[model samples]
Target: MSKSIEAVKRKGKAKEATIESKDQRWHCRNRITLVFGSNDVEELETYTYEDGKLNFKTVDFHQAKSKAIEEILDNCIDEYYRGHVTEIHCELSEDGKSVMVEDNGIGFPIEKVPQVYSEFRTGSKFKDEETDEKGFLHRTLGQNGLGAAATCLTSDEFKVRVRHYNSKKEQTYTFIDGALKVKKTKPKPFKGHSGVRVELKLSKEVYKNDVVDEELLRKRIIDLAYNNPGLTFYFNKEKYHYKKGLLELAQRVDPDTAQEFGASAYIYEAKNTKGKKVKGKIDLSVALNLSKKSEEREKFISFVNSTPTFDGGFHHDRVRRLFVNSIKDKLARNAKKEKLTLVDNDILTGITFTIGVTMPNPRFESQTKRKLVRDTHLEKGIEELMNKNIDKFLRKNKEYLEVVMERAKSRNRFQELKDASKKARKQKKQRVEKLLDANERKKRELCTLFICEGDSAIGGLRSARDKLYQGGIALKGKPMNVAQAAISDILNNQEFSDIMASIGLIIGVEADVSKLRYSKVVFLADSDVDGGHINTLLTNFFYQFWPELFDQEAICIAKAPLFEVITDKGTKYIETPDELETFRETTKLKIKEIQRNKGLGEMSPEAWKHVLSRESFTIISASDVSRAKEMLNVCFGKDTSLRKELLMDEDSSSSTSVSVSSTTTSSAKKKASKAPAKKAKAATKKKAKVTKKKATTTGKKKAKKKTTTSSKKKK
Candidate 1:
């Protein structure tokens, strides 16, 4: 034990020789000692543990420096808590190496300054009794005095300047590297005010990073200001002033929380429990709002002695139990009239609470106080006190209470509907499963649900498809226009309900994807305009709520060929005009006949088997679902203007093609109709011209004969 003690001491004050050859140094070897003291400085005792389980762990220097700053700032706050200070001003150096805080409180005794700096344990505020002659027990922070001593010992320099207005004197003490360097005392002819100003810079050798974080320091300053009402805090040229205490803080955290409650926030300060004034009173600030979603959880923030008890203790539990019980009891009496009752979870789901407590001699689990321990007296005291206040508030605001009860009723109704739907879906699915023979197949095999347009289509699929791996659901006529209908309407439709049941899916808010029965769902429809429309309707219905169904290769469209051509070579199936052209150009075979499949009813079972096979079909995939949704909206949405424009453009182009064809046919008919009339007219003109020529020739022949006879007579 002696050797261990010597080793620890040497390590704590290790010289340069023990340090490694590195530019940076670390002084994490110093050990902590617990100190207890009294009003008289001579009776101080230093405590140490000799157990082998002792821990000499080093703390993070950034955090240690922050705690040191907090210790100094907390001392100033203690003065305010004791009714000694009114204002506090904190300033951080631009380089963020040091911090200074000055207050307008009564300064401490100056003669004991050197001893307080050099000694391990020496200070005031240690009393066994509840109160002294002045009735002041000092319920303020830093009652142990270890915090201040540790801060000075860990710093490179600690300076204290005091102005004693009461004594009309001034004093100053300076500590350099844990030693008292200078102490000065002088008379102030006219002392303006009295307070203590402490400025400190942490020792670089003791801390990994000694620079102060300005933003974190500001938040702490503001929080202190908030908790200590009527105390002003100024830092970084900004002022934080809060007079309403926790109520103001709750408002800042969530502003609309109180307003939505249909009443102002409920603020209560405990006066006494069971007609006896408690030593330290607890304060409560509560805000409530009825959640539209019943799944939302309650939120709570708690504090003890202005230090956050992030891990809640007995006080928080007491507050919650009392609050919930108070409301539940009040609602029980009106349950019959309101036709409902509520549990604790239902009542707690809509509340936001902030609790504050101030204790004179508070106990914590550790020196770095992250949590508070049980205080039996405080627990019972706060519960009894809060019960009455909460009861009064609930009774005063019956309207808000009604809203909360109504929400419970709504949630209950919703749960009942969901349960009923689940039951119905299970029963229907069982019935369909029997028909599908779904239990006979292996679970890992590829199973598909084939949705066809009509009973005829289903007949074709049933004969052609492999029944063990394929199931069919035949939609009557066309599927309901899902875009313009509500979910309830769709569910109530017999065809859609049957289709949903066949697929083992529910059609409402509690829809579950994991419960889906089929691995793939393929729409097998006739290759026509009506078939495309039905496919569109089905796609819209599924994409509206369950778009994730398409993430896997589960949903697709399988094509059915429109034309079957028999030729000298063999029979070929064609879906588009280009396919026909390719068949004629590539095969160059003598065509026997062409069979056009107007619908699925025209196809024989063998043809259906040939067409429904995976190789002969084109499966269209939705590459961009968002773009598909946009197109579906324009084509199938309730608004008809956009669809009307598109249809009009298509019709105008089709009408133009019809008009050109009809115009060419009419002109050819007119030309054929005029051919006989033109032939008769030409024949009549030819006859008239020949008759005139014959008449002229006859006259000329008579003249020539008379002239010839006259010439023979003359000869």
Candidate 2:
């Protein structure tokens, strides 16, 4: 305040401000950002199509500079929309500093060329409520008429050559240094198709860098070609022509999955400024490339009129919201049946939408037209288009609906796994309530976990197992077939949860062998058919999620002895009937008593000791993962027919064996019965023969004795 007062006292009064006026060219050169967009360069995430593939990249994008060139191209597109242009040719110079655009269209009057290119707010397309000869409103890309003129005023040298179709006259004009100098040629009769050509080099002082991006320029030209059907474009001697325009572009992104998504055109009526009824048409083209396998987020490439709406404003939002609602309404019943809540991402992921709209007098947020502003007519057009075509689209793309459902299921499963992981981490800190832990805490890799059949088996194992290296856990019954159960179901089961906690395992995570509580997991159950089933069930549980454990030879099976035999030599534990037969045939010891164990609870301590003393167990392994998976599916999958076939095959084989055994037993019984009868007959005949011989011998003996007595009496 003191400095201000001192200055005021010295000057005796405040100095009056001066006002100055600036020309259009001077204003455009200084405030180029306001007329076009940002003056400096920025990084833009964009995509381009090449080699039949779409590639995404981050590029240095200069908005104002790009808009300067697009302004000229927009003029050509405007002429195309009016049905006067069919082909546009664009080229970038070798030095990348200058560009030329030529279009084959009916050029305006030759005398208006200089004013059209150099003056501000002075060209055509300002009458928004007018209609063309067809009684439809004029739909064009240029409405304000300042684009080409502003571009002309911000350039180092701007040249224009126009050949009027009606007049059959041609003229050329050149403006130098922001139109500070102007030159023109005399009008003359022309020979070729009527058109206009413009060549310009942007001023380096205003642009900071005058060189144009050649790749971006070519991309823009090709986008225009795709946006305008039946229009031909040439850039750097390369030709681009499309009949199905945006649909062709969508196919370029992904040919197999691309399809049209909406109706082509919507027409409405409006009153002009003169209160005359006029028809306004909104031509819409929507193409979508959907991928069921991709995990990426959705992408949108949209345009209003012929301008690329990179920022995607009202049109994009309206279409996206409506499309999502349409799909949600269609899948509501299915989602409810599956107990799922579908989010926008689940419906929208892996989809690329290419949308193009041509409407009269479209509004934009800024002069660059990167983003569109809301328009009532456009909104109503979109709503009507979606209502007319969404049901048909869904009907045709049934697999797409299935894909959305599967995505929802996967998202739900992922969240369940996350919650399970948190619960598992909390459980990992506490002791497993039912686990009989091993004593080897320092080196857990040396420990073995024996998953026994029941509590009785675990009790026996507790007494017989080596406490230092062996641990035991009991299964209530067969473990859940993980293939048939949901992740949440498996996680909620008490037995499975305890097992994972005991073994330091986390669902949905890859197992590390060294970090596991036990190096070897052995399934110990009764040596019966049910026990065999339990072992297979356990194998499927481990192998379905953690196959690496099998690869490391950590999954194994321990054979529980079915028989304990006491002999004169020693006690033997026999695991199978064949093993007992082999031992009986090979040993020389005297036979004693044999005890057969019907279940693990009936096994003797000696049998348990024999099993625990084994050096190693039989490892369960799969050489071919595909075959194993198929077999498991047949056995444990939801399809009962597959399991029925497997069991029927097994029953057929068992029936064959039974039939053979019964036939052998019957023949053996016949042979034994016949031998007994024959043996009895032979014994009776021998007895008779012996009796006859003995009688003869007795008579002879008596006669001899009487003769001897008479001889003795005579003596």
Candidate 3:
């Protein structure tokens, strides 16, 4: 038998009981079975209403805790939005365990306080249905009263205090672990103001070792202060006051507006063309961050009934479309005189706006109210209101239109240059493909192209490589690091262009993977620090442009030998430091000379034959694509300060092991301290000099100065 817990609330108490059943099924409030198995299971179900409204039945631990906090916060904000309250204060406990919200709004009736926390779907917001004389709907932030009750059920300790001056009464309720511990009601002094205060600690059973994220909490509180015109919030020894409302909020979020385009604001009390009252009234505030043509910035934030609509549903779409159309229509009338064409992006390149809608009956996509659904009547009314207001605003600010026109023209020119670059790259790719030998063309199915670091490294590879199936592209030096290079820069790079052509695939936004020339594209660099950097740079290049190549197993890192250990039995290859230590401690074979490979050029043709063989190499891959992107950006992005911080962290760490998807070799280390260590150093320098001379004779010009290696080792 399996056990599941169910919550049941009575008149003034909340209770929980565990029921054992052989069926081992979990049912939601709507009697929908969310999960069924032969053992106990934790399941979460969403109850969807007839109108497609969905609410959480049982959420995950973190989500449940967050929902509990949001529920309580929503109740307080709802009262504030109704215009009854002006002041709200929130406090997080010093220990980071509990939080409290207090609002000076019209308090609930003292007699109904017990049922409000103990019952579901029971509250004051659904009492009215009539529209006001001003054409405003009876809209409130919250309709159903399940928020407080849900919080009570999900919390280990919950308490609520209410005072009603009009009724001259006060009530206090407390509950522990979903069960009511106490309830008290009495007459108030009548000299004080009325309000509600709620405090709760999330249940440990549901959420283990989790506390409210303070930064996230701070953002919500600050956003509320900005969205609500007259609301003042105090939390964590700070006071967040917003009197100028959305206009002020816009500037705070996107501060670069002042430097980029000189901001503009258009606030209007929207009215229909006939100057008569519409079905619903709307107050629109648009704060635009008009930028210079070169800048790229786009931000949009919207709300309905003082509650944030994060997904930006009907209202957002309508506003964006109509706003752009209004500008386009005005610009088209003088298109010949201006000598420019306007597109949607022209008017919205650097724009931000906050809209406030008041409707008698609002339709939201979900019970959480994250998105607003379209209603025909509401749409028509908003359209008429916005068209009239936007038209007038444009006429008053003709200079803003001029700036928008310039931006659109700049975008058009930029697009033309991109087209030209694409054509050139396509032609260059064909030229590189023609350079392939007959064997390469015949063995395309099994062909592997190795991208060597420099000319010196390719000679050994060329001598030992299987020419029928294996091709080599010798980069002059470390080619332009594609991690931070632009598309034009990458296309212009001879090395990059050749690699793309050799691989038989276009490397860009319009890349076609189906035309790949090689079954495998490997980065075969030196077994030193410079090689690792080159490997990282090339990986970043493919990851940035042809990310699908990684998914198809077309991109891989060749596991070049770090140290070649000669023992009495045979020569053993070692790839990592950890493995080398274990081999030294466990192996019984008499140790001979250990060669620490400084670069791929240091390896002889015989060693190259062994390393390049199909069985001797391992392919390196990203454990996850997102992590690879983050690592690449941090290490190779233009942010020098961030890179410095990362380098500093590396120096402080004890181990410098890299975590990749997989490795093939068992024992490897860059440093060898066995017999003939002095001979190994001299051998490395002699081999490097010979490789350089051979490369020069073969028409490869060595770099004037050796590139600084951050470290002379690789994993």
Query: Largest TM-score belongs to which candidate?
Result: 2
lDDT by residue (tens digit), candidate 3, 1-715: 7787877556866567977553111121111111101111334332211121222244322334555576677777777656678888888887767989888887878778767876767887774343345545345666766667766765677888888756766777777766446545564554567788888886665555447756546656776777776788888778888777766655554455521111122222334455654344444444554444435445556667666676679888887888888788878866656455787777876665555565544677655566799967557756766765775676656787888877865675566446645755565447563233326665466777888877777788878888888878788777677755655666777777777767765543444445667777788887666676677677767777667776666777787777788999988888766778898999999989788778888876667877778653445566676666666666667677755454444332223234331121111122212224666778999999999989886653334322233233331
lDDT measured at residue 694 in model 2 versus the true structure, 0 to 100: 100
Question: Model 2 Cα displacement at 607 (Å)?
Answer: 2.3
Q: Answer with 1 or 2, whichever has the higher lDDT.
A: 2
- In candidate 1, what are the lDDT values of residues 132-193, reduced to their tens digit? 33543446666655666667776788888877656766687777775535545564543577
Candidate 3 Cα outliers beyond 4 Å, as residue runs:
1-64, 128-136, 180-191, 207-209, 254-280, 293-297, 333-343, 395-411, 414-715
Cα displacement (Å) at residue 594, model 3: 80
lDDT of 3 at 125: 78
Q: Per-prediction TM-score, please? A: 0.52, 0.84, 0.48
Q: What's the CA error at residue 248 for candidate 1, in Å? A: 1.2
C-alpha RMSD for every candidate: 22.7, 16.2, 22.6
lDDT of each structure?
Answer: 0.63, 0.86, 0.63
Q: What stretches of model 1 exceed 4 Å from their correct place?
A: 1-29, 32-63, 117-120, 128-138, 180-190, 259-299, 325-351, 392-501, 504-715
Clashing residue pairs in candidate 2 (N, C-alpha, C atoms within 3 angstroms) = none
